[model samples]
Target: MWELIQSNRRKSLILFFGMGALLILIGYVFGSYYDPEAGGVVGVFFAIVLWVILSALSYFAGSKILLAVSGAKEVTKDVHPQLYNVVEEMKIAAGVPFFPKIYIIDDPAPNAFATGVKPENSAIAVTSGLLSTLNRYELQGVVAHEMSHIVNRDILLMTFAGVMLGVITIMSDIFFRGMYFGGGSRYRSRSSSKSSGQAQVIVMILAIILAILGPVLAQLFYFAISRKREYLADASAARLTRYPEGLANALEKIANSTHKLRSANKVTAPMYIVNPLKREGMKLADLTSTHPPISERIKILRALQQGVSYNDYQRVFEMIHGKKEKIIPDSVLKESIAVTPVIGLTNEDKDFNPIEARREANDAVMKLNDYNFINCKCGVKIKIPPDYNKPIVVCPRCGTRHQLR
Candidate 1:
């Protein structure tokens, strides 16, 4: 496990530096073609400065930005006690440095994601639909999965990659727009001679090609790492919770839901437990996907007959795909010790009622909005609106007087 963390840290560094280098490369190419003198060096300097600023923002404020983009609102334990308790349990189970703040997105998509550079500065967000759809055990499974991402440093790896990908896409769009508006023709006309003009044109062509391919390559880079990490987080969740079936059941429910997430975009979609953008047919080995197939993931979890360990997951992975290839590193697998699997809640106890879940979530939201809750001895729960402004409230069912506080 330590080896995997170290490896992820190494990958994060590589991604950060690789992005900075690419920015400098693009700036130099554009500057040299535009101004033949020392402009290329100046462009490189500007790119370096921009990269530092962007990297800082990515590390410091990326999670906040993501939350804002998803329209997620932070909630206190009082606002959603059940959800809060699940996060707390998973945080302790995963042995993270701190409990991540919780956020809720009021969307109908049954999906969740984690963000931040490290465990101490992390947050886990779930769609309101997710809260309304999953049972307590299923929610625990999802929360554990997200917590394991924090434990495994997947957030840092994917966040940096996302930052780089965004930079490339922005730079590419600016370059193409400049070319579309006669910036290239103007530069060509400014050349000293026909030979110089032709040379400049060739550089421009190369720059254009680079600009076109740069974001695609970065995106592919992100997807390559992301898919593997999802699998790893799944395995880690099973081991942490000691109930692979919980997650397996959760995955099946999430996959079966047809609700589409309204706030999901390409940049934020990969961070989700399941790919919000994926349609029905994408497979685990799909190169373009940021997640393994839900079916394959569930199968691997169910196949962990011995126990939830890296060795068990790796064996199942290879068996399911019919190859002896390694998913967990040799050192990590050797170090991983399986524990006895524990029985989970029965199907009768685990049965999720979506209507009840939805009502609970709505009631929580109302409470957060300052609606007063009154409990009657007659087993009636009354919610008084803020505008009611009544000194005393009478329970319609039991005729009990309850003070509105």
Candidate 2:
């Protein structure tokens, strides 16, 4: 698991530098077209600054934006006591400082995901269907897998990669817009006095080609980074739980489920435990995918369950998937595999009402829709429908009336 972390960290840095280089190159070329030496200097600076600002924003706010776009609502222990307990226990096992917020989506699809800038600010969300369908052990396996993502900071790496991709896309758009809008007019005016029309045509042709290829190259880079992170997260999860079968079972269940999550779309699809954008008749190995095939992931986990070491797992993964596993150190692997004691149910549990638990889950889902309150200011908690959109809601806490934004 440590190896996965180190490898992804290295990859993230490489991508950052690669993106910086691309931006600098584009800036220099465009700048030189206007003023040979001075323009190149200015362009490099502009590119660096633009990349830095955008990267920072993505690092801090990307996960929040993703959650909002996916329509996830936060929940508390009172709302989803089992889920909160599971996540909290995993957080302790991972030895992270802050526990990730828990969230529930109304979809019937059995799926879940983890997201945040870092473990401290992270969150784990699951579909209502997942909670209803998965048994306790199976649910622990799923939560543990997502917690692994938090520990390894995969979310941060993904966010950074996304930022770089965004930068490249924006740069490409600017290049194209400049070309189409006659940004070269001043250069043309100056060059026309000293050069032939053929030279001018050559410059425009080269500029147009660069404009078109820039975004394409950026997209390829984005796809490559996204795919790699998914693989790394899978390996990390397996190492963390030390019970690959648990996660494997969860994946199998997700694959078998037919319900599609209503809120999922192309942009937020990659963040899901399963590809929520169900593609009918599509096999797992199709080239156009943000996630690896579920079958492939299960195959790898099953192999791990048979006493395979991390190195051996990597070898098998590469043989089957054609991608190298990031080399994780023994110490990190041991640390990640560490588990906390499970809270065993006692005979006293019989005193608690199962019907009440069901009611709580239902009410929580309903409260989520009426308002996004995970915790109330009045100290009393409430749950609502996932799709409820009333303008006013009475807080169960203190009976205060709160207006929806």
Candidate 3:
């Protein structure tokens, strides 16, 4: 496990510096494009400010912000006891130091994600669609997968990488907008030396090119690392649940779901267990995707026939890819411990009701948002809006009169 952590840290450092250098270079070029003087310093200052503000937010309030952005409401056992139990089981299995706070998003898209810079304090948020759709074993697989992200300490890396990518995009956008709006008109003059004029023109061309390519290069870097970490998280999920099929099935259902994740945006798409954004013609299963192809992930997981361990997943991964390239680092694989799948029905499964679960999900989110619930005698429940000023309400279904509390 230390080897895994160490490897991630090493990769994160390289990504940090590599992308940081690209960001600084873009700033210098664009700054020089506008003013060949100290404008470069001002440009760098702006970039730094944007990066620092976002970085600080990531370190301090990232988890909260992401959950809020996803419209997740904090939930207790009473709201969804099965989800609580699943998360607790995974927390113990993964040996995470703390029991992460749980949240439920109201969206019908079946997806989940983990966030927080440190393992000691973190959170796992899942959409209500996931809760209502997945069975206990399938849900356990997803929770374990999210738990792995916390244990492996890659949340910070992803967060900061996203921040850097955003900064580069913003810097490039500003430069291009300036050029389009006549900021580049002040670049050179006939009074300057011929050699100086030529140099200025060269800088302007380079600036334009950097502004165009900056976001694309940054996205590639971000997606490359994102895909690697995702594979690792999947392998860890199988290890923790000792049931590769569980996660494989979960992925299948998620991929098949038609319900769009209305809460997802471009920035938060990578944090999800699957890509939530729907591009018109983009094939997310391609090589440059933010996530490994769902079909490929399912195939590899389903191929693990022998044991449940990092080594087993690695063998399966290689077998499917027809190559020996390692997904889990060598040091970690050498020291891996194995577990067998726990079969049979869990207590939560016998009485599990998807309809009830769906209702619970909706009710819990409404309650958290301050909506009042009224139980009618005719089995119809009425939800009173928070802003309703009337002292009494009539049930739409039962036509029963109820007083607002």
Which candidate achieves the best TM-score against the true structure?
Answer: 1
What's the C-alpha lDDT at position 219 in model 2?
64
TM-score of each model, in listed order: 0.91, 0.75, 0.86
Model 1 — which ten-residue stretch has the worst lDDT?
Answer: 182-191
Ranking by lDDT: 3, 1, 2
Per-model tally of clashing residue pairs:
0, 9, 0
Return the lDDT, model 1, position 245.
83
* Reference-based lDDT, residue 323, model 2: 68
Model 3, total clashes: 0
Residue pairs whose backbone atoms clash in candidate 3: none
- lDDT per model vs. reference: 0.82, 0.69, 0.84
Q: Write the per-residue lDDT of candidate 2 for residues 315-341, one digit (tens) a residue.
A: 658777676555444454454433332
In model 3, what lDDT does residue 268 have? 91
Sorted on TM-score, best first, the list reads 1, 3, 2
* Per-residue error (Å), model 2, residue 20: 1.3
| Candidate 3 residue 352 C-alpha distance from true site, Å | 5.3
**Which model is ahead, 2 or 3, in terms of lDDT?**
3
